[model samples]
Target: MATFAMTRERIFRELVERSNRSGNAIWLARMIASWRVGEGALPDYLGLSPEQFNNLRSHCFSDIALPHLAVSGKTVDYSRMLEKQDLETLLGDFRAPDVAETEWIIAILVAGCLGSDHLWQDLGLWSRSELSGLMSHNFPELAARNNKDMKWKKFLYKQLCEMEGLNLCRAPSCQVCQDYGLCFASEESTSVIDQVERNFNRDA
Candidate 1:
């Protein structure tokens, strides 16, 4: 397992390096890679049930595009939000620069533990700047080329589609789809994004 973990970390590091990320982007990617290796060991270390982790993971994704609505206060408490020390332990060698970064890491881990099986809905929790930082770290090459005016989610979806060779169209096929407006233009999505941004910034 240790050897496998090293190999995975090396692969992610090589990918990040090959992308030519620099400054905070490079640092963030390195930290994320290092932390990712400890994922399989998280349940044991945190004294968390793998089953319960999976259950929370389920609420992270949904075809309805309102996963956050599913996250009850009880669910948040049950998820056992990690403190700075717990994040440090799970992160191992990679040290987060501050509390915000640590919490960001925790959010990513929580999203992962809950399962990244669908298009990410929980990312709405992050503010514009926070999401921008993530784009820089996770998709440095794409992030560098993105037009500043582009919404982070749009940039992310575009990059993902390009990477996977997927042609995600919102014409005839997507127009009739339930999630059409969620990813594209819709009042609901705009409201949700605005609300989350306000909440995140206010808390910050």
Candidate 2:
């Protein structure tokens, strides 16, 4: 069997290569690549299991991306989220004096929320409040980077809404706001996103 480090390295390299070949955005590629490597190594590094890694990936692709796409009006084709040209345009439009910090925030949010189970389900019921709370408590640095007038919950909700409007989530939902009712259930369901988020929060 390959050593954990070696497996992680291989997985990372494969993800990078695949992303490059598919013309995936660098940031998106990095996010997935990290998960691919981390999922493989985390079990050995921190006593997780292969099943957990699979669950993490499932939650990410489904719960995180699904609701996001619903709200953002974005469509994902195959395994691709943002097209290369569109991603380039977005990167250009959002250019800042400190690009690194912006990138870090995006990366952190993608890693934390996309891989989380809690953010998905019945129209992402727990997403806004719980995730906002988690960010406020665990990632104060991220919270500090936002404009002073922006509250964490407000920021997260706004971003999610924007992403939905942009159709970045996959297949965007078209119903008018007033016509839509919450799709998520108040109680726990057997959703992968929910399970992973619960596990992550407990571990933290």
User: Each model's C-alpha lDDT?
Assistant: 0.39, 0.35
lDDT of 2 at 198: 64
* Model 2 bad stretches (over 4 Å): 1-79, 83-105, 112-116, 120-130, 134-179, 183-204
Poorest 10 consecutive residues of model 2 by lDDT? 40-49
Q: For candidate 1, write residues 58-115 as lDDT tens digits.
A: 3221121112222222222424534424433434333334423333344444443332
Best candidate, TM-score: 1
In model 2, what is the error at residue 184, expressed in angstroms? 8.0
Each prediction's total of clashing residue pairs, residues at least 3 apart in sequence or on different chains, is 1, 16
Cα lDDT for residue 181, candidate 1: 52
Which candidate has the top score in lDDT? 1
Model 1: which residue pairs collide? 57-114
- In model 1, the runs with Cα more than 4 Å from the true position are 1-126, 170-204
What TM-score, computed on C-alpha atoms, does each candidate reach? 0.29, 0.24
Per-residue lDDT, model 1, residue 10, is 80
- Model 2 TM-score (2 dp): 0.24
